[model samples]
Target chain A: MGNRSKDLLQVEHSHPSSSRESSLLVGKNDSKPLQQKSYLQGNPITVPFPKSEVLGKVKDFIGVISEANRNLRLYAKDKPEEYDIEVLTGNESEYIKMDLMLGIADLHTPESLAAAEAAIAGCQSVINRNSTSSSLEFEGSSEEEEDEEEDDGGEDDDTRQSGSHVRHKDSELQQDDFLSALLRSHQKKKPSKIIELSVQSGSDCSIRSMAMATLRREGKRLSPLISPRPIEALRSALVPYQEEAHGLRYISTQAVRNRMKSVKSIQKITKAMKMVAASKLRQVQSKAENSRGIWQPFTALLGDIPSVDVKKTVLVTISSDKGLCGGINSTSVKISRAIHKLNSGPDKEAKYVILGEKAKVQLVRDSKKHIELSITELQKNPLNYTQVSVLADDILKNVQFDALRIVFNKFNSVVSFVPTMATILSPEIVEREAEAGGKLGALDSYEIEGGETKSEILQNLAEFQFSCVLFNAVLENACSEQGARMSAMDSSSRNAGEMLDRLTLTYNRTRQASITTELIEIISGASALEG
Target chain B: MSSSAAVPFWRAAGMTYITYSNICASLVRNCLKEPYKSEAIAREKVHYSISKWSDGKSEKPTIRSDVAED
Candidate 1:
């Protein structure tokens, strides 16, 4: 079995490899000799070359210089006692030249090289004074030699213990020097840090003045580089304060007054809006109650009919165009989306007929392809049967559908409403049921005149039903919108009142604090005069 | 009995009456002829009711009735 398996594997592998070898041989036969002959006859042959080689070399050169500069900077920072400025500057120049010869040195600009040298020089001098004061004996030791000596000493216990006492004293002095050098370098690197420290300390006026003078000098020198001066940055940051010492008190009072005025005005507007919405809610609620008679029975009838095999359905979503109606519009939109999701399949096509601007704006963002028609400005005035009839007629004439589903917010109470959906069967479905004498048995019993066919009568009935249902849905939605708006405005007014209370409390406390400070100043002045 | 009593009488009767009225009204309107028929059709085509609150100007609400006047 093992031999047979090996034979099968060999056959499978050999078939592709042998075919690949034959193809390679054919490929060579056609062009290999011609290419070699061209090369021999001194004719140029085209060959693809990668374009990134030059860029790659430039990047590598930059990387090497940056890495060397980083290492040298770290050495200068960590072990200032072992640093020799003159030797370091000389080695840096030589290393750079060697790297240039090796095709890796691209730091050719004078300014950058000068900057590197200046940074090294600055770092060297920072620790030079401290190192010279303490480590005069080890001053001439190279960095690598010192490291090697330390490493070798670590290997032998006798030598290590003998050197520990001297090393400890040296290290103590080195720590002080290193800390001072670090502070100096940090001050130079970020002048702002020193200025902030001086300002925060506040006890030493002489030091702050000196720091300011040095920052001014550095700012002048680095002006071409656009480095922000510490003094200038501080001045800009404190620009809201006046130059005069007493101006701060007057500015605080004026800012407080302005804030109080704006908050008061906002509170007034929200209070007025809340009152208006509350008054309007009553009328809208009554209208919604009256319209319940129109839609409730139709919905009941619709519920009795069994679900049909509908290919196309029209979804009519009712909402108000205005905002600040809480989540009424979003509720209708969510219901429509869920219904659309349920009806979505390969064979089912759902088209949208939106009634208000709010739902149109939302559905258009995501389901623009399904929106067949959108009717706006319906909420500018209160909805009535006449407007809805015209809307229904327009929808009926424009689109063909087997069923129509209406989505609207149903007013349950003044504070709450539910997003509801109701369906209306098309005339064709009613006629089919009548013919079959099955689901819509009650609809089949209705008598028609001699001139009108059963289907035409059913069509007229459906159109009338659609208008009535749309009118009811719009009324209910409008009522819900008003109720929601009233509650939302009430809550906003309450929140604004709370905010006003907090602001007034803050304003009064600030006033009292300023008053107390002035009184204390006067009392101190009086006591000093008496003394 | 209390739940049934809670429902208003007009609500129970109004739905059937309106549905029947609408069907009858459309059928009767369909039998009319000439200018009267055209006027009735136009009137039935668009309906407008007065809003409770006037939005500044007392102008009637704008209507987009493009039902072919035929």
Candidate 2:
């Protein structure tokens, strides 16, 4: 290939351009002979752009320019004058240049860049949250240790049970067991959960706020349960325990209080996350609803597509780029793994289309060979049907796939997001979807005109399928993300609040003990004087 | 391009000139007039005349509280 042709090809392959045809048209001017001395006078082979920085800053602008120029030369080979050189300035330009070099070097997937961006965004968003939600403390216990302790207690309670008076006794025992289990679990989980809650609250105040609201509700629920415990025995045991351990209880209580403050902060963050997710989910749901209207009629026109002899399959896996929301990415990853396991043969290799950066990373790590095409920045403009169509077209034309499968987290509601898989290319899937039935009332109302050809209908159907798959996947993934984030924040806030409560109690008790000891010394002194 | 960038500044200056008198008048009234006004001038003179050498209220309280507690 000519220098210009090579540059054009590189640009088409590497950069996120609006279109490739425009570059191709420009690349035809490659006959502008390499007569002019090179862009830089230095030998082409000498000192390939400096990677090191002097005093934490690039010492050579020439090196940076040369590196950019080299790639641009390759990219601009076909279309030398087409690229806007101004766009190659500042931080954005530097990063773009770096990415181009990385892409050429073939170090990582395109999703890796997106993942790094999402992570930075996530970190910034968290920091912003911490600053705002400073006041509210929703304290709770941690999940891991609490889970084990509760599981054991639940097992013990379940084994002993039935008969009126015995039932009453059993009920009493169970409630006590439950409370004791909760308290014990809280003691174990409180420290770590408190810290996590505080840090998250600091990072994301909205979640902390939500957690506070949950804690208030929990506190109200806990109030009724508090009285049934044998207070006298517990108090006596606690008091001696407090004294015997060289003020360890006092310190523990202080730790708990501080943790509680952290939890309250965290609750605010979680609550905010939930609200944000809820709004985003609603938007996604509407998009999905609209997409259904578009796709159902399109599919209906096709009548039926035979699913027999499914040879090669293309699977589009959708997940969120950033993970604070629990199990959203994991669930999608699981579904992908399941699909990989099901479609494992040399002839029937599964071509993977990863929608989100996080899912792409996971799938790439798991099945290195299967990821044919990966896309990121779905979260930036999730409802862009044009992008989806482009992606779908690339899959449909470039590769031979007998069928298409889409896996994503489905948004049932604010709290319930389930991992769902749909076979898009198969008639069986459509038939099942039609038979199993869904919320397609809006779609049924749209009327089509007479004598529309099958080809047009198929074209429309293909477009609709792409749009629907993209829309539904985005909605489900987003819903799952928000829900998971809310819960995580909620737990953190609760954990913090619990720590504060324990701390305040200890502080009070310490004060009381000091007062009592002082009184005793005064009384003893008085008695000796009297003697 | 240079001429185009400077055009807005000249327009802004003309607008600022039109509002200058009113702005100056408001500044004098708002900033200077208030301080000269007197409130209970006789009481202020009495406090100035009979100023006793005593600790500030905050300082007195701290002293009293500490002594009482002791």
List the candidate 1 regions with Cα displacement exceeding 4 Å: A1-251, A297-309, A433-439, A445-451, B1-70
Instruction: Mark the 10 consecutive residues where model 2 chain A has the least summed lDDT.
Output: A98-107
lDDT of 1 by residue, A328-369 (tens): 999899989988877778999887887777887888778877
lDDT of 2 by residue, A1-531 (tens): 144234434543453432322321222222112111121222234333332122122123223433554565477677755544434444453211111111111101222222322332332121222223222111111244335544644443343221111222222333223223322333332323211232111212233223322332333334344433232333444455545765643334455456656666676776677677667656666766566555555456433242323667777788877767777787888987888667767566776777666886676555756666655655554444433444454445445565677788876665677787766554343333445445322333446454443333333354456555665566557766766776666666566567657766777886787777778889999999999
- Give residue A480's lDDT in candidate 1 (0 to 100): 89
What shift in Å separates residue A194 of candidate 1 from its native position after superposition?
16
Per-model fnat list: 0.08, 0.00
The TM-scores that each candidate's chain B achieves against the reference are: 0.41, 0.25
Worst 10 residues of 1 chain A by lDDT: A96-105
Fnat computed for model 2: 0.00
Question: TM-scores for all candidates?
Answer: 0.52, 0.39
Docking quality tier of candidate 2? incorrect
| DockQ of all predictions against the true structure, Cα-based | 0.06, 0.00
Candidate 1 fraction of reference contacts recovered = 0.08
